[model samples]
Target: MTATMMTPAQLARFEARLLAERADAEERLAEFDGVMTEVRIARTDATADDEHDPEGPTMTQEWSQRSAVLADVRAELADVDRAIARIANGSYGVCTNCGKRITVARLDARPTAELCIDCARQAR
Candidate 1:
């Protein structure tokens, strides 16, 4: 693995931040899973026209939103895991797409980022 440009303090901070975010993401994923399961069960056992209910979002709509959130959280957790692995291998501050040092500000804002600003802009 390539040497990281980040100082030990910076690396430690980023690692801490990523770990915290990963924990939050995992919690959210679990919460979403529980809510999704509940909605599924409720919809399955419903005798009324839940699909056309006017009181609130239908079970299908709630499920869709929860599933989307769960997917995003899962992806974020994966990114955090990858970032932690990079940190362990001494490549945490290197941009995966461009082989350049990722800016400190960018890293501070998103500790799990793998691409530099240019690469990320291009990716979008």
Candidate 2:
């Protein structure tokens, strides 16, 4: 499959984006952790009258949702880390499956992608 090569400028942009995303993911994970802590505290403080607590269930549901979100962010963070490693190894933008240079557009859209569009679509 044919692949588009990224210029050094494009690679730089991708690196910047990855770094920003990594920071964002870390922030989000921290927020989730804080929310989970609140949920735990609420559950622990619940007493007899508060047993039918509406806030408790809501907090639990929110915690569950945040957990799922945290998982996704963690996965993306791992991908970004791998992409940074590839850049350090001079293999940035190269498709893992076909050894073709991944397009700048694709990298801009997904800076952590390891495969080109064709291989990615086919793999799916």
Candidate 3:
């Protein structure tokens, strides 16, 4: 049987989802950037008195958290970008594993997925 194709409306909905996610990631990344900038400036100023810097440990902890969060946000952004590209290339819903059409349910659940459920299960 021929694979079910995505309708224009469905594709629009998916696009909106990807774009919304991308915006959210961007927001988080910007927040992370702000935190990182403050941390960097605080750490590098060299004038922060060593006598009893109350912010030292706090800054260090925040830096570590920001780094980890940045990593996660970047990964999610990459996935969203890939999904947008797939949509543009007319390969959005096709499973990379078996060349089957991925169900709308799966795509809605994971817009960045490249593999179908069966293939993903086998790979796991």
lDDT of 1 at 88: 95
By lDDT, the best candidate is 3
Q: What lDDT score is found at residue 56 in candidate 1?
A: 44
- The candidate with the higher lDDT, 1 or 2, is 1
Q: Clashing residue pairs in candidate 1, if any? A: none
lDDT by residue for model 2 (1-124), tens: 3323566777687788888888998888888888778777776776444777777777778768877888998898899899988876778888999988887778877888899899999999
In candidate 1, what are the lDDT values of residues 24-104, reduced to their tens digit?
Answer: 888888888788888877876663556555634565687788788888888888999999999999989898987898889
- All candidates' lDDT scores? 0.84, 0.81, 0.86
| lDDT, candidate 3, 37-109, per-residue tens | 8789988663465746777777788878889989999999999999999888888888887888888999989
Question: Residue 21 of model 3: what lDDT?
Answer: 98
Candidate 2 off by > 4 Å = 1-6, 47-56
* Residue 87 in model 1: lDDT: 95
| Alpha-carbon shift of residue 96 in model 1 (angstroms) | 0.9
TM-score of 1: 0.86
